[model samples]
Target chain A: MDRAIAIDVSHLSKSYGSHVAVADISFQVYAGEIFGLLGPNGAGKSTTLRTLITLLTPSSGTATVLGLDTVRDADKVRHVIGYVPQERAIDRFLTGREHLELLAALYHLPKDEAAKRIGELLKLVELESHADRPAKTYSGGMKRKLDIACGLLPDPKILFLDEPTLGLDVQSRLRIWDYVRMLKARGMTVVMTTNYLDEADQLCDRLAIIDGGRIKTLGSPVELKVGLGGDIVSVTLKESAKIPALESALKGQPAIRAVRATDKGLDIRVESPEKALPAVLEAANRLNCGVEFIQYNRPRLDDVFIAHTGRRIEETTPSKME
Target chain B: MKEYWQEISALTMRWVRRLSREKFSMLFTLVQPMLFWLIFFGNLFQRAADTQVTQAPNYISFLAAGVVVMTVLNNGLAGGVDLLFDKENGFLERLMSTPIHRTSVILSRFIFVMAITSLQVLVILGVAFLFGVRPATGLLGIAAILLIGMMFGVGLTAISMAMAFSVKSHGDFFSVLGFLSLPMIFLSSALVPLAAMPGWMSFLAKFNPMTWAIDAVRPLILSGWSEALPHVGMVIVVMVIFDALCLYGGAKAFRRAMG
Candidate 1:
């Protein structure tokens, strides 16, 4: 019942002159799981992926892909790993099929087998209709699909998708999400890095929340939300004057962990919203505070991020948010 | 070794395919050298027969070998432009991340540059023949010209690729390329013979590898193997040393960048 490790990065650090891009990071990706490095743009997510992909050497520590040392056995490691970098790597002049065919050759795939695989990948990415068109003529989503097909050409054991959905439209992003799920269904281990909290929550089996080149917390989406120890209860008051009284009354309840006043309401962190809702309502009634509305929110990945990093993911990546 | 060749062939084919698709690039690759031959050098030395600076029947015959060597030089030195674009666009990083033999990246580029330069050499030679210049050594001499051009080209291409990785931006890369290539072309015998240049210019030309390549190729085109064979031998030795030094430096720069 033991899970196999597809990627093992231990104490990996990378520095550029005086700037440390990745600082003493360690994590493991189990086979068949979509592991995610969740962080903002400068959080060393791409840097970690780059180091593991062997495009970069770590300043210290070790990383192994399918048990091959990324630095010493880079060629062997690369053989079993597929990497789709943040930037599109397709040649604009080549058709989608030509791009895949070229990559198959680079991976040393046999000619007939490469041809067959290219055909299959073209259909899989839904680019069969546009496969013969020059990549420059393809839409953004088509080009991205071709890029993913290129990464998948070698039938790699572990696939690294670095910001795979960055700069993509919602539909395009969803299409990539489906591809990632399909990859996982086929039992391919995927390591994806993204600043999108929803992407990490929806796609990843487990994720490490990274910020400032360090891991703030790591676990499954459900585990991370559960680890915050409660559901969130946002109670809006009819008047701002009711805030102080609601805050005191809510803090008195044993089910409630913490209470803070927001601009529009009182946010109560409690063990169970179902049990605490009535108690919160009772507390507000006793305090003579008129309740305008109450919203019961299960802790989101964003809340988990905020709990650990003291800043919302959106706040950190303001520019990148759609 | 088989895998090595496969990797090099695949990568080289990528470049070749890209070049083939760009009709303008293919046209310019062939035409640029011929333009220099016809418009600039051909016109400048048209009256060389009336002057004592030349020994050949006409200036185009002497300039034929120079044009071929110039094509090699231009192709080799500008070879890094593609690599620079690859670096800028992230394709180079993608290739580096693959299971390829790292040397294949540089070797494939060298192969691509040589292939294009060879074709350009033929086009120049063919055009030169129409203007009354024939290689005295026949097909064997044409083979020698390709060998010498490729030998000298390997070194220049390596150095150009090295600069592509070492520099920060496209502007810097092209500026450095222009700085190095223009001086090397003018100082070498690509435009005129060593006798045609002033004594100081000729002294510098002896140290120029392009000068040695021209000296080796010109006689095969104009005077046959009897006079050209020794210079061919000397040029081969010089090219090997030059290629070794440049390839070493280029590979080192590449490793540093990858790190």
Candidate 2:
């Protein structure tokens, strides 16, 4: 049996004046699945999430959460959805427990229920020990946990987490990952946007790689990698000048799909690295280019991104792109 | 309807809880208007009663009503500062993304401002009473004073919230607020009677909502219900119209900002 759809967005487009932020993006998130939107800064990931959460209205097209129109039935959609914004939506003056209780009330939970849920959420986030402390005194990770706890107070059917672990330490990020897994086990549908490629690869059951306000690719991590249909072979040559001879020697081989030079090595894409390595070694010997290092590995999400965009995901981001 | 009230009360409690933690700002908001009444205006007009420059028995009693309105004005106008910070810090967006009614957000802000302003007005009245002033209308008059102050406050709070949504930053919000508040205070009957002002200033004061509020409230402190009732009714009418227009504008701006 097919799973129920938790979120459905179709031909959604958002624009600011003449600049389109989300351009005709379409996707569906299934119930009880962790769906990720992987993109660089200014790639419209947050904009799409914001529109679905009803914080923003789309310029054109329609989005629905659990069959409630995001624009027409915005209030109803909000009622059933929890949103953790990219920015820390925390009040420094309030304690962690106070924040949760306030959100519980805002969600219209009963007083007794709110209290019980707050207690459970604090424990779930492992913030029970410091729940009474002012949020201003909490570290970045602690604050993020508080934010996620606040979002979970409504027991929402769908949760939208925008960069849930952005700017966190490794330990804090791992903790958040665990919480997300736990949430999925409890049958909650989660839609998250992240810049961390590995995090998306590991946590998201399926993801859409968005860039330039468009969905470039969409599939499970393994499926996306397999779709690239090539293995990556990196060869470090003793001199950069020898790259030209190596390329010429391997250019006519059918197994060798593509070749590109990097700062330290030549990155070759091929149908089979096992079959392609012998030809590469022979070419290196004939060209008098010493091979300092060589390795073959399966395509990663980064490789999939590079294959689709012709540039690394990191290179397309705001800081690196500039 | 019950759910609306529940959401409003919940959101209002958030503001109240934050306000309670901010001891210094709470103290300042309550005490600043009283200082103006007791120290600045009170001493300056010390001999006005002797000269019959004022209609009341003393300047403190006449100024007491104005002080109450001023307190409401200050609180109402500054009410959006918290909202501006909320918008800046993303808290407002968080609240907006929830299942609560959107109007409840703005309504709760008005409620929180009115509640705090009512307390400040009481403290100002309590201080004026210590200075030998008694409202001729007594307890009923105190109720009228609060009603007038709140009516005026609702209009001002609506305008402030509108500005908070329209402006881009807190600095711009504050500058606009400062530009409006001082002129509004001087142009109204807050500091002195309209009769004492120049002809043009008096004419302008007639059009000022703040003037209408002070006019309505001043009689409650100095005279009885028979004299104060008409102005009180007029102030309420003005406030209703003013709040309707301002709230409509604020809601429009808020919607645009959310978009």
Candidate 3:
């Protein structure tokens, strides 16, 4: 709605017959920010991103990229936006140089400028030496670097990377993450989706955690973690105990908000762990029960996810978003 | 207009480079038509030469012209299979997302196939000359026939691309292409003269546009024009209609892909 937002979607939904792939989702990504969509395998992250990129039409609602309607002004959107799909789509028979050249031609670049830009991008991605090798001969990391370079060829204002590092090794993944930071430094707005929570924490300035085609929560990594409270304490009970007794014992504690049974243990969300843990241990002692474990680390993204979804993100093997 | 020209130039250049890297494919394109020219048409003309069935001095000249057009049709229709592979492999999606004019892709492919088809025609004509069938239409007739051959090529290219979207696999698409081309060639006056055939075959040949094209070009190979011009006009009209149908079909496929 305002000048700062780079992308906006309202009540977007997509359905194939009776199956809903994405439903009633709304969010905005601001300019010059690395915004991330964090979700599990079938959380409608790709579908939502595809709709925003104008690859798939939404069944209802509207999406805008750079102040242009995705459906009505798709050509304008395509001109200014670059999309790096999850699947590697480069021609394997073409060399890295040829791939970039073909992509530049597709973008309608003048031949001289296209060649110049390809040279710069090759150097930027450190693939200059291997530019003449066919993409099929390049390692996975090299191919991915070329793919990124291809996406950057048009000098897009906002780029969408759908699982940019889905199957790369740690070193290659880190390299991609590093370039993403550089892209941000150059004032490019990037929208990325990944199942890897730590990637969102390390790379994204702000993130939205989505589940079952809905935004569960949105904020910077630290903001979301801090909002979940300061520290977490776990107690794996050997046997089930009286619910009322345990609740009453922990009631007067200063920072503890709620305690519930998790699969591995009893979990507690608290405002401050340093002051809350002593009381929790003392309560356990009085109940003649053992505190299996107590940890005083900051809340992780998994905790943030569990707080909202009432289930672990990894436990559900997502076959389809529908 | 300039931008469209630039896009066409760039697309055509890329394919030119691809063909250079794919020399084996060139040989493959030449062998089928060449064999058909030398073998089946060779036997038909040899018998016709001994007998007096055709009005033309040599049946080889007539058969050679038909073979050249048929080669263009086969090669051009297969361009659709290339497009289908491009789509299945994600190349088309990548292309559509870019800023280039979509029409340039189809036109460039048609031109690429035409260029190769024209060269194949030259080879067939050279062989026919060596076999004592001088091309009486000379350079002008050769140019006219090649242009018509290109029209035929563009028509088939567009139709195959349209079918690519509807078909499930590359193999199925090629099978349909074969089914479409073979019958059209046989039903037309490609291998034999219409005068020598049965009434039913002659009627079918009259209706077949491939017959029109062959009938048009055959006169040039035999130093005659009076009979060829009318058939040439008919072939041109039919090619335009097929081109329109294929263009509309390709556009529908694109719209479906978009949805």
The TM-score of predicted model 2 comes to 0.90
Give model 1's docking category: medium
Worst 10 residues of 3 chain B by lDDT: B47-56
**Candidate 3 backbone collisions, by pair:** none
In the range B1-259, model 1's lDDT, one tens digit per residue, is: 8888888888888888888799896686656756676557786778844435667787777778777887888888888888888887778877887888778888888889998889888888887877888789999899999999999999999889999999888999888877877778789887777887899999998999999999899899989899999999999999999999999999899889889
lDDT by residue (B25-124, candidate 2, tens digit) is 7676567756666667886787754426568887777787777887888888898888888887778888999988888889899999998888888888
Residue B12, candidate 3: Cα error in Å is: 1.6
Candidate 2 segments whose C-alpha is farther than 4 A from its true place: A1-4, A226-229, A236-245, A261-266, A287-322, B48-51
Chain B TM-score in each of the candidates: 0.94, 0.94, 0.89
Candidate with the larger DockQ of 1 and 3: 1
lDDT of 1 by residue, A82-189 (tens): 888665677899889888877887888889999999999999999999998889998878888988988898899989987888778899999999999999999899
Q: What is the CA-based DockQ of model 3?
A: 0.42
Q: Quote the TM-score that chain A achieves in each candidate.
A: 0.92, 0.87, 0.89
Question: What is the clash tally of candidate 2?
Answer: 0
Q: Report how far off residue A121 is in candidate 2 (Å).
A: 1.7
Superposition TM-score, candidate 1 onto the true structure: 0.90
- lDDT values, one for every candidate: 0.86, 0.86, 0.79
Q: Quote the lDDT for A30 in model 1.
A: 91
